[model samples]
Target: MNSKIPKSIDEYIKNFPNEVQQILQTIRSTIQKEVPEATETISYAMPTFVLNGTLVHFAAYAKHIGFYALPSGNIAFQKEISKYKFGKGSIQFPLNEPIPYGLIKKIVKFRVNENLEKTKKRIQKKKSKPNHE
Candidate 1:
């Protein structure tokens, strides 16, 4: 495994195999296009995109590439992702299968909206809190 944490999504994609690298690159580009404000980094040993918090993460596995949108994402995509193997925040795309780039983009956009809502709520909560100091 590469010990270096990539500064950009392109460098992160270069760390993977040729084919998987291509898929990762496409996913990264789509996310960037959708969420221009998001910052890229390697978190939890996977390539993560963050806005107010983690928006999504993607990593290469032996037989599949995993995309993690966290908590509610799995539930939101459950019906569309039912055919594929997935966990709470992850969906595995088999190495031999075609990557659902559109779906990934849609998920990224949804995450962006989710993060914005969270940030708004957090700010509102902070404003409503009493300062006792």
Candidate 2:
């Protein structure tokens, strides 16, 4: 939440308090554990994981942590996430509440699969297209 754009996830996490730092790292690890091949970066000033496209993005806010797994991810898990505060592509997990690591893992896995499927379709589309060259 500083003016400086964190070059890496580590830098972004360090800007938070110890408790928030712990939560952020746990979320990062949960995503990585689910998809070992996912790449990490700082996107939109938050810690982001990318596979075929962005897997997920998370950031610590004053009273809550914002978890973004894109619109598809949120929509797919609508029932499970309904209890929490959510948006088109984002979920706000309050700091006072227990962070649902299990739910986070599920969401990450879903996004990983979704992203991979998109990549597959893109490849198939290219294969079906007539060569112009």
Candidate 3:
């Protein structure tokens, strides 16, 4: 693990090699295209985008770039992401192979919608709760 924490995604990407930086930038742009309103920040030591809540996160690794769209997004896009290596909430796109920018865009869009819906439900639930005094 890197001891030096990056202040921004640009700084994070700058630490990597040119090839890795390009892949990271592509992932960032794809996510931005999906959720232009989402706020960008560093969370969990990675590039995180938050809308209603944490929309998604991405990080560059030595061999692969990891995309974290939360567990629900992985379950929702199982068919597409199955082609690549994935964990509960993260997918690994290898640096040697072509990154699936299209699928990444879809996942980001899915996460944005999920976050929005969850936020809406949370607000509604709060509104319906009886006053405790």
Candidate 4:
């Protein structure tokens, strides 16, 4: 795990190899463009976007890039993303393939909405609970 936290996502991307840096920059920009309010941070040694809550996390790997939208993100994109390789909460995009920027944007947007909905539901649940004396 990288012990240092990047000042900004741009700084984080700059630290990677030129090729990986380009892809990472694209991913970072896409997330920022879609979720303007998202805060960039280093979490789990990877770059993470925190919106209404923790929205998504991405990392540069040896042969591919890993995008993680935890909880149920993989399940949501399973069918649509079957062509690409993936894991529990991650989807891997090989360096050779044209990076799927559009799909990545869509996934980030989906995660933002998902987190917002979860927050709303949690608030509603709290409101419905009777206060104990």
Top candidate, metric TM-score: 2
Off by over 4 Å in 4: 1-8
Compare the candidates by lDDT and give the number of the best one.
2
| Model 2 per-residue lDDT tens digits across residues 59-86 | 9999999999899989999998999999
What C-alpha lDDT does candidate 1 achieve relative to the native structure? Answer: 0.86
Which TM-score value belongs to model 3? 0.93
Report RMSD (Å) for each prediction in the order shown: 1.9, 0.9, 1.5, 2.0
Error of 3 at 83 (Å): 1.6
- Computed on alpha carbons, the lDDT of every model, listed in order, comes to 0.86, 0.93, 0.88, 0.85
Q: Residue by residue across 72-128, what tens digits does model 4's lDDT show?
A: 787887886788888788888888888888888888888988999999999999999
Say which prediction, candidate 1 or candidate 2, comes out ahead on lDDT. Answer: 2
Worst 10 residues of 2 by lDDT: 109-118
Clashes of 2: 0
What is the RMSD, in Å, between candidate 1 and the native fold over all Cα? 1.9
* Model 1 segments more than 4 A misplaced: 1-8, 131-133
lDDT of 1 by residue, 61-128 (tens): 87998999997887877888898999888999898998988889888888888889999999999999
Q: Poorest 10 consecutive residues of model 1 by lDDT? A: 1-10
Clashes of each: 0, 0, 0, 0
Clashing residue pairs in candidate 1 are none
